[model samples]
Target: MKIVFALLWLLRLLPMWLIGALAWLLGSLAYALARERRRVGLINLRLCFPDMSLAERKLLIRRNFQHMIRLALEYGVCWWSSAERIRKLVTVKNLHYVTDLRAKGEDVILFYPHFVAFEMGAYRMNQDIPLVSVYSHQKNRELDAQIYKGRQRYDNCYIVSRQESLRSIIKAMRQDHAPFLYLPDQDFGPRDSLFVKFFDTDAATIPGLSRIAKLAKAHVVPVIARRVGNRFELEYYPPWENYPTDDVEADTRRMNAFLEERIREIPDQYFWLHKRFKTRPAGQPRFY
Candidate 1:
């Protein structure tokens, strides 16, 4: 079984388009056969977009499946593609926004949600400015090893484990790094997270960003990478310059709400497969 898995991993390193086609086929098959996830996807969509009719919800669900597959393929291709080739695929804007923050001696925390070209955006950012990034480790040891190799391809990238505390991320910023890039949308277990309202449903959100930003005096910036005209647009939203909130939970909730707004704008670009509303408050059933 391990041998077969390793062989498939090797195939993932093939030319970009070939791997993309394979992932599309695999995703379509999964969407067709995985009744449980498909139902969950549809349910999640309905809850998020209550105004949409049945046909509209179904269309989004199908597109979401294909988007998931394309994203899987993009991961393999982005890691293997050269700088020149990768540049052609993503168009970046607001570079000065990040640079200006760094110039002011402000260590920034870039919050990115799970998007189709997320991995590619991570890679491209490191090429421009080395960042200390935190990545979730895969269960498969072999797959994790390969992923680490791909992440380290550029000059300014570093990975930290979840076991590491907020101080570690602060230290990375103190080293004059670009940004401490991370996604806070996933479930962070029991003690590591708090329930925050995302898209009208309570979702687990990591408070690490708020704590670390307060401790290090770093600025929190929302960054998103979405498909635009067959390429990508990596945009950096300026920090809330006039922010008045000192409360960690309130600030984090506001940041997460901003992410939810972006997701609504481009529903198919976000990762719907993740059980976003996995941990619900008492009396509330799991939404996905």
Candidate 2:
């Protein structure tokens, strides 16, 4: 993994367009080589977009694979490139949502989904403001150190591990007024997770958005990063009104629904290569 990432770091010296083409090529090769993962992506697409024909689903998966590769390759830039270089490659949309909330002395929760250009988005946001981010620990120590240093290199940005107590994260948001860059869409099992419908499939999703917001008195705003022909765009949404309404399950479902809508806009950008429906409800057939 370290060797591969090192190669990506070297690849970062290439022009952005060339980097994108290289990523697409690598992803195409990965799609051909990683059979089981490709199967998982296909299964996910089938379940999510049952209305589409097989040919359409196949096309989407191929494009999705290319985007996924681009994401992996772009991590080199995300980790090592100068902020000014990233500024040149990326642009923001609806940034006033953040400025307005911060000006009002409100803590912000960046409700982001897992998109292919996610690293680019996170790095860009970190530049705009100091971030309080949640991250899961990687198993590889050397690779993890690289990732950790890259993410926390900026000043005063706090990163709390998901394995720790949620109180630490809640406390930071509640008292420190740091913008929590949170991504709660992925499956984390049944523990503290509610079964929510993601594209009509019951996915075990963490309900941290409402839980944290209610505790911190923070405003939740949606953000996403997408690639447009080798360039990146980060979009910020207005805070959800009347959120964390006594219904946690409903709020979780609402998040999934919002992600579903967003995913459709950039179908190939959202994650589909993993077994999204892996941890199924009781009596449900195995999805992968």
Candidate 3:
């Protein structure tokens, strides 16, 4: 299996159409076999986009799988793609925002929701800035090494484990030169998390983002990367008001609210298969 993956990675160097076609075929096969996850994916889509008719939601679901496949293949190329090559693929709209923040001696805490080509955003930023992002290593140790290697391609980009970096992130935030990129939408352990409303449902969101921002006095900048025509378009959203309260819970809620609104803007770009609302509501029956 490891050798097979290596061969697949080597093959990814071919034309994107070949890579995308193979990825779509593989993703389709996985979806067909993954009965439980597919059902959960559909359920998640229906809940999040209740206004969409069944047909519309189903169509979106199909397209979502194709996007996922493309992401899977793109992983191999993310690290190797040169700045010039990458720029050709993504047209960044708000270059001035990032430059302006750095010019003012202010480090940014970029919030990336699970959007189309989300991982690529991290790789691209690492080329231009000091970016440290957190990630959970895969359960398979061998695969985890490969994935981690790919993610840590850039000299300035560090991939810190969730456990080890919890305190370090806060420390780094205080430094004048440290800027962090984070994906704040995943489950944090019960003790480390707060339940917040996302897409009108109670979801578990890591309070780390808010706490780190408040502790480090960093500004939260929301961003989404989506496919435009044949390439990607990255839009840098305006920064949110600084952590208004010392209260971590209140801060978490506000940050989540920002992400929720951003996700709604390009709904299909968000990752729907994830059980974002898995953590049960207070006094509510558990679903999973």
Off by over 4 Å in 2: 174-176
Q: Which residue pairs collide, candidate 2?
A: none
| Cα lDDT of model 1 by residue, 126-186, tens digit | 7788788776798988778878888888756767776787777777777875588878777
Scanning candidate 3 in windows of ten residues, the lowest lDDT window is 170-179
lDDT of each: 0.75, 0.86, 0.71
How much is 160 displaced in model 3, in angstroms? 2.6
lDDT by residue for model 2 (184-243), tens: 888777788889899888999999999988988889999989988879999998889989
lDDT (tens digit, per residue) of candidate 3 on 110-155:
8877886887776676666677677677888877887788766665
Comparing 2 with 3 on lDDT, the higher-scoring candidate is 2
Which 10 residues in a row give candidate 2 its minimum summed lDDT?
170-179
The most accurate candidate by TM-score is: 2
- Residue 132 Cα positional deviation in candidate 3, in Å, after optimal superposition: 1.3
TM-score of 3: 0.89
